[model samples]
Target: MALKITWRNILPGCFKAKSPTSPLEPRNQVSKTNSLQRLSLSDISNNGSFFSASDISNSLIGFGSNLHIFTLKELEMITQNFSSTNYLGEGGFGPVHKGFIDDKIRRGLEAQPVAVKLLDLDGSQGHKEWLAEVIFLGQLRHPHLVKLIGYCCEDEHRLLVYEYMARGNLENQLFRRYSITLPWLTRLKVAIGAAKGLAFLHGEEKPVIYRDFKASNILLDSDYTAKLSDFGLAKDGPEGDDTHVTTRVMGTRGYAAPEYIMTGHLTSKSDVYSFGVVLLELLTGRRTMDKNRPSREQSLVEWGRPLLKDPQKLDRIMDPRLEGQYSMEGARKAAVLAYQCLSHHPKSRPTMSNVVKALEPLLDLNDILAGSFIYMAPTEGKKDNDDVDIIGNEHEETEAEKNEHRNVSEEEEAEKKEHGRHQHRKGYRHKHRMRSFRSRAVYSDTALYRTYRTSFDNPKLQGQDIVN
Candidate 1:
């Protein structure tokens, strides 16, 4: 009898029965003999014929990939015919599903789970974006960039297999309703990691412009390490003497740089601007744009930019969710870096390398401010006062939001949360006030620390879950 496969057993990575490989023929002679060619995004953008998925196997191979060819039947078998049970989430490309591969499938193929992204025929992105992802990820390999294990092109179907990121993306973690605020040091660690990923891309022999840089595109692993994923909009940096690559203006609404939006002149600085927006999001615990918010406060960059430059206004814009437990000096340094990154003048912006430098030191500044961030749970008759501060409309979680924290423990567990909390109670402005993030109120030094830990970890493990 054929065994049934599902999401639960899919974890820890396994393999199903093997099938024949795809029939798409390699048109060009893939030369592993030559040095792996770093793809030029500009070159690919200009040549329409070069973007053909069926015709690019040889080139991808030349760029450095054995190019494991998987047939549609193999993917379907592992994912249980792309059943809803195994579905991860949807992005611009299409719906992704979790799958597994092991030695049973192919010898020497490590036993591991993978995230498979299949292109939606009628989706916003098409073969071009899919092709771009193949070229960039195929050749470029880095610690912080998501690994493209293999891909499938059978007839009209296009699917990409990536190393499964257990924690999912940064967007959901940061913006999810009622979600415990990410610890200040964890936030800093993520920033540094993401910066390193971008630095590796920009610092390439011929720089690559990561046109699509946003919170959603930054996927987190079990360690909360941020890896830049989805290179559909990536472009190869311009050659010698070319100041910038002029291309169609493309990126998420609030994250795109002003100059790139107006003139279509793309540069590494454009990514820096987008990075700044994400950094601000991390710093203030806000979205890049929220239509639901007030008209004046809709654009987080505009509202937060002014506040970032003014140190006195730091607390006003700092994620109130932090509750005065964050590093004051570190926050100040991060704000200045964010301000510099958000500069209107592209030249004024620092390179990704410089951004990495600015963020690395902040991770070491874990000295918690000597104050208490007391959050009293919302009661129906509660009034806004010195004690009852409302945070971003008191996030109301829908069924979808409630189920969002799955597979995220690794990020929290490996984040050294216990050590961070141990420091939280070491110094407090108020020693005897305890508050339940849920529906209760008490005050004590020990209980306050316990409450803080309890509220942050919803379904995630606590106390025993911390990494040693």
Candidate 2:
């Protein structure tokens, strides 16, 4: 007997199986109202967040739920057949791909370009992730959020389609060497945009909660504007003022809220905490968390929180690349807002709208302050200060500062190159010795064989065959 394997068993990561009905197919059992009665929103919210076979018979938004869906050919055609050259970026879930769909030809498409995310089938549990993203992004629409184009479910292949962001993600722009230096204003705008997106999610009618909000999840467009991306960890915020939504906790380690980490309960304030971490990254140009830092200073939120409180110490936290270009007032306000979000008590944190209000003035404040920062900064011996630790290594030399203070020249680069070459040669020798071990093993085997053969042939052969 031939074994029958359903698509669900074969496909590892898809959230749901598509129905038999197509975009053109007749509504058979799928349109039945009797099954619709069982498909309550409460059922969806309480259990699996998945539709049952009976629920599949009912309509979801406008489409039938049980569609077997995408043909291998259609997916291949959409993603250029999963070409390596079209690959965009890889993540914990899978590789993202850049593809061009002639939206002009598709039935429901408004005629625009679309990007596709094909879940890596090897080791990812991305079907659930894919479902969460589609369900959330498809239903939620906000100016600050990226739009989900559609999805494809066929055979074992699962993919998500999204409107392309030209500038990739915010992490790439902030720290990537190749990325253009985002002016102070652009950074502020991106922060505000991201804030708005989070606010919308937290304050929605049913209040959807974005469980994973990080710099990498924030995508940028052609104009360098920001849009919130990635909703794989999202959940519908508790209905009827339950105060907090609880679930099996899932999120990146550093960006997760402390309370959520201890208890599985999640809330809008959890997102607010993560948002504060992103804001710190924007201001200081440092990662949210780094293990390499001394144990006392590892987590950015913990380390930076103290400095954020004192305006006098804010300069130590500013990105050195900005070179005194940002408004001290704007920077201080940002610092205070970040501190509020990082509060030990989630209730103490302000709403996303409050964050937006704090960041809005900085949109134009960068140029308005301009070179005027020389005057805006409090001069030495100013009495407006309180107990401040002076923040950061104020006495230590900044890279640029050291160059000017010590009068270092081009010779430094040449000296460093020579030192690197010496280290490279040492590494090469170690590698060569490791590779030569096989050859030595073969020679040793030959010698052992010769000795063994001689020993069998003659009792006196051992001493004659031996070599140093």
**Cα lDDT of all candidates, in order?**
0.71, 0.63
lDDT of 1 by residue, 218-330 (tens): 88876678999989888888768998998887777888899988889989999999999999999999888887889988899989999998877787788866766678888
- Cα displacement (angstroms), candidate 1, residue 460, comes to 18
lDDT of 2: 0.63
Q: Model 1, clash count? A: 5
Model 1 bad stretches (over 4 Å): 1-36, 41-64, 370-468
TM-score of each: 0.73, 0.67
Cα TM-score of candidate 1: 0.73
Tell me, by lDDT, which candidate is best.
1
Q: Give me the runs in candidate 2 sitting further than 4 Å from their true place.
A: 1-42, 45-70, 103-105, 366-468
RMSD of each: 14.4, 21.0
Model 2 worst lDDT run, 10 consecutive residues = 458-467
Tens-digit lDDT track of model 2 for 42-120:
2232222222333342344433332223445665776788788666776555667777665433655555555667777
TM-score between candidate 2 and the true structure: 0.67
